[model samples]
Target: MKVKNIVRTVAAVAAGAMLIPLAACGGGTAADSGKTKITFLSWDNEQTMSPFIEEFEKENPDISIDFSYAPPTAEYIQTLQTRLVGNQAPDVFIITSENKNDLIDNGYVLDMTGKSYTEKLSQANKDFVSRDGKVYGQSISSWAAGIAYNKELLKQVGYDTVPSTWDEFLDLCKKLQDNGVSPYIEAIGDGADRIPDSFTGAILADKGIDVTTLASKDPQTPGANEKEAVKAWMKVYDEGYASRDNVGVSGDDAKTQFVNGQVAMYCTGAWDFSTFEQAGFDWGFAQIPALDKNHEQYAQGSPSPGLAIYSKLDGDKLKAAEKFLDFMVSDWSLEQRSKNGDAITVDGFESDVTEQYKDVYENNLKTGKYFLMTNFYSNPDVLISTNNAEVQQLVQGSITADQWAENIDAKMASAQ
Candidate 1:
């Protein structure tokens, strides 16, 4: 109990102070037996990511990945935002369409400006997660929503394949109905407000006029292109091509109908390939049959977001985090993703996707007929629930297509 004892205590406290900078899970990386530890938060469920994480850990034994998840869309974004603002976000996580810009603007996303991994990324991916060439995300895949068909159903209607052209598509729809099969079905559930809008957009894009390139903010108010596009979209419902039941349906319900043989075709994204694989029938993918022969195929699409780092990360930990991103786009990861029905899309990354989405990968993406709604208009909300309501009314005959166009312009104006 003398000065010597006090000095010893002081030295111990100072040594602990030197290691005060905290790491993940309330401890430093050194706590895990000298392995640099990093956390990865994802929108994907644990079941989907568990096996991948095990492989990643096996390949890089020096770095341990602590995976966490939240349901996609709103729940995921909200959880990530709350944690990041509280200075407790994961070392790496997904940068979704909803949270990408906000994360970048706040300087929360790391700038992999000169990293070798940034060199061979796709333009669509780069542009989405970058501001003026500073990359903040690693793109793993690109997705497009288009026409999916049941091959066997078409044969019963005297066709080997669905037709490509507005008139022919409609005629084919009629034939299927006459044969007691529902020709087409769409799930207009909330954010799934894309089917009709995609049709309208394709009609516009076919004529070399897209909403992104419009001379007027409200194309419908400015020219015949918008009006014609609306009419084309409405014609499907007006003439009973896609049944009215679509309005009451959700994506899962519509998919169920298609799988059960109640419908001949589905208008959806490639994400549905997994579910359709169990349909117990032959099926194939098709580009939204060129709006008509004159116009090439047009579909809705976007580059999928990827693993991003916290801007403040550095040292061996930062290096380890980069390794995870590299692994995400590596041939191994892409192959794993492709096997699960994803279309791999990193610039230099290649993997074999299922044949059902071959048309989307080979033809549609190359020709630029695939457009993300973000390119056309960035609405205030991600779901577009209001737009869905208006479209529902329009399809129900309570409103005209012109009124539908007006409602969207109003929403656009309100958002602006």
Candidate 2:
């Protein structure tokens, strides 16, 4: 919602203040030259979403989409929040881990609980945007983050593929380090650390702990299981398998190290494919090793943010918004999304992911063997920021793994 200040004359200014909205004016269902206009605020840029919008418009000639964009994460959240608070929100917008609670508690997004289009979503995709058995968003894809190891580097260490268990993985790291290779590097400078997150998933699965149930507990104790996971993950630093300096490394820095052959493995995901492909080396991606031989392999990931209809939308405009969501799950949209490199998770649709990432695609994404701490915890933004700071201290040996977990609990309790 753009507000323009117009002061053409002193007399007009003295009379009253007049504000006019610009191109970003379509808040709800507005008639655009006799056609119902459904406003949509997209996290994706126009280039990525335009083709679908055009196709949808062509399919339903009576409904026009007043599409707008804000880049993801911070800017997108702020833009949506501002619009929602100002009572000028779009008919449709994104629902993500960062804003799901607020959106639901405030009755901002419509429940897609019994919507036919929702029936086509994968269970994991449905659960990601769901709260208390009611679905709110149409999430259609997921991404997994795990170990990306250099094939040649691992070959030098006499390993054909990444091991499936944590102990063996550490042994391999030891071998790589003994051979003068920097063993492993994962960025812990921001967000929740992926290594620990994967370990937490494995632990949770082994213990049969339901994430949703854990999420419902008090915020102070929500991350209780994370203690064991963090303790296991700390072995990398405790045993000197990974560099303590990695606490300061950014994701790009870790990727750069791997690309430069300075590190044997980097903890990342498919987003690094193009850069890895251009690095002139044979690289392979694999799910993060299980917590132990008894545990299932898991990766750190979550479904992409989902599109949700505004709860206030009704009448022809609401119908138009629903149609737009239905089109997203249509065969054409799935195929296009697959082509665009999303690991499409809509039911009956298989993404043709690249071969290097096939391990993660098959083992983690397909089976829902992935976890994200922020996705399951309360005050997600606070959880991530606090976890990042606490984990950095754990890496620096300034605090024990147990202390890290305790700190996380205390921080979350205080935040609540």
Candidate 3:
């Protein structure tokens, strides 16, 4: 995972490409070096993936790995897409809601059904791995999305506990606002951001709807349940709870504001630990408040980062790729992940999460309430992108609740 090692590997690969014709004349395949090397392309930079890679290499001396990382989700997606199309894809890659379909549809990823690695996952973990009954990825962990609040802010508002009902939440927000604090701060510029934490929860609570199903539909003809979910989201706008100014706020901006004590609560995922730790405040986490008293306590999330093998790999290289992936889901890998604050998904591997966020992981464990965000589960990327823009506009007061919902519907339709 060292940057230098990565640079060397990439350089070697580039050089190999240039030498392909020469090597062809010399009558040696790239695999002729007598070692099985599986190239892994990760969205996580080299530093984060280094320890795990080291562990895998130490355990399997017969197989060597070369890793290349692209920046995060966006750049990684573009890079992998190009690589796959060019037949220069890495032997193993990270798969997520964003690029799973493209990989599966184009046959870039291997079908992992009945593989030994697939059997190691629990049934719940299996759900995200399969598409139309064909498995393509191994979901490593699960996460929860909700509110992270400053305990001091709640105390100032005369509350010892985070509100569980929308009504009380609004009242709390109003109190915080009166006290010269931004009651709630969220990244609303992208439809896929805030909705997953707030309105998406409301939608799940309202009708027991599965966001994935609705998102999978023709965007133009979003089901009645999906529309209702959008309506519930608008309630935040109607009540002046979430701000329209958030349209200008990036995720980093919102996190900074929350950490600096400018905001009382932030709606985001469990992954914001680094941000919260830097904030000089006493904080607590909780599930998204339920909609009314009848709604279940639901939050949005997805399987954490996971591994996929490229379909192009065959024979010994394919076997080595599969071995590395299996190593990733082993008990040791889970323990490493737990120690690193990863939420647990594989059965029998519990999280050793930090004390501050223990409640967050505990709630996810207890309720089994973790659900992937709508955009992650949906198709045509445009739906998620458009919805993100429209939601940001809605938060900024540039658009009405009806307009926001209409925009969502329009995007969904156009995608179809």
Candidate 4:
């Protein structure tokens, strides 16, 4: 679970190569034409963005677009870094917790304070855009991750509702086990799910401590709060609810098992909805189960993926970039997004969520609950992504819980 271990693995892949060529449009460049062209570099591919891009282009006919995409998460960051260094960076790009600090430190991203678009989003969403009161990136949508369960499996075990408390959840798991169900399936091998970390977040929030603060603390310190959170995860391991064999199971495998009805509950996010639906199961979503009677419900997520203008652009191109970004956040843009079956990130935009998940969306909004996977502004390069696999190993019994906590601390220390 060391950061270097994962980083090396990713860096070994062709997709991990530092300087991927931007997808070139066959049309002429900005200098040749009267129109301004702005390149949009994103992790999402052209097909995923076709609807939004089409609408934006239609509304702003004068501005042309050059769209590009890289693979998700780590590879995307490395690709963007290479682009910035070579001065071939896109006019606009995604700024997430993984690369936000490095981009800010290098002065590659534009300061968006006082922009009209920044004011258009909800205040809560706006909080994510600013660092030291200077806005940089605007989150287009919010996200949350939790247990998506197979309803029929639960009913077969004589349960109608997903458990709310950890104890009840454990009881339900036992029941599912008694009835020959795999109770829960977590992605231990993927090294990113961090199921234990999520349960720890809920535990910290329950104790009236900030989950981010807990994460920010030195994991090696072993304070009372840290121990409590660690103990919450250890309970799952000690009770045999989770397995060490999961250390070899990837996220896709877990999803497949859940979809195949091999497991009752799968820990994941709303992003997995399409995968599950395609899996063809009678499934539904729920918040992460509470840790205890006193614990408040909580779920882990990432900041809405944002589109930010790169600092290097100027003149008509700058104006074009602004126009494109504005269109991206506009109501018209949101409507198109809804129609295309994209996930909702903005407050007022309607979602393309399946009818079965309407209640899940409503409940998340009603509770005002969210926890980012990485704190974009606060600890951008702190190696939060590598801890999941280690935690998974601990749950699956490949590694001890103490070793998992220590591994996280080691990564944070190295990053510092």
Q: Largest TM-score belongs to which candidate?
A: 2
User: Could you report the Cα RMSD, in angstroms, for every candidate shown?
Assistant: 11.5, 6.6, 6.2, 4.5
Per-residue CA lDDT of model 3 for 1-416, tens digit only, reads: 00000111224344334323210111134643666788877766666778888788779867777777675555567667767767788788888767776777788889998888877665435656566666788876677667888888889979876788777788888888888877887776433354334445455646655444543544334323345555666566577767767777777788888888888888876667767876657888887776567766666655655689988788999889889888987988889877876677665677777676566566654345555444334553555566566766666667865776677666666565
TM-score of each: 0.77, 0.90, 0.80, 0.80
lDDT of 1 by residue, 1-416 (tens): 00000000123333334233322231245545868788877867677777677787789877787777665555566667767887887899888556766787789989987676666676556655666557788876677777788889999989887677767888989998889888888786533544444455566665555343332254223213344555776667888878776778888898898888888888887667778887677888787766566666666676676678999999998998888877776677778887775666666555576777777776655334565544333332522455567767876788887776677666565554
lDDT of each model, Cα atoms only?
0.67, 0.81, 0.66, 0.66
Best by lDDT: 2
TM for candidate 3 is 0.80
Instruction: Give per-residue lDDT, candidate 1, residue 29.
Output: 50
Pairs of colliding residues, candidate 1: none
| Deviation (Å) of 6 in candidate 2 | 36
Cα deviation of 22 in candidate 3 (Å)?
Answer: 20
Runs in model 4 deviating more than 4 A are: 1-32, 73-75, 122-129, 192-194, 200-227, 271-281, 312-315, 365-368, 373-386, 396-403
Flag regions of model 2 displaced more than 4 Å.
1-32
Can you give the lDDT of residue 197 in candidate 1? Answer: 44
Can you write out model 4's per-residue Cα lDDT over 43-142, one digit (the tens) per residue?
7777777777777777877877878888667788777777787778888899866676677777888998878777666443554555556678876665
Q: Which pairs clash inside model 4?
A: 97-376, 141-345, 142-345, 191-389, 243-396, 244-396, 244-397
Better of 2 and 4 by TM-score: 2
Q: In model 3, which regions exceed 4 Å deviation? A: 1-33, 120-125, 175-182, 189-216, 219-226, 312-314, 365-368, 372-380
Count of residue pairs whose backbone atoms collide, per candidate: 0, 0, 10, 7
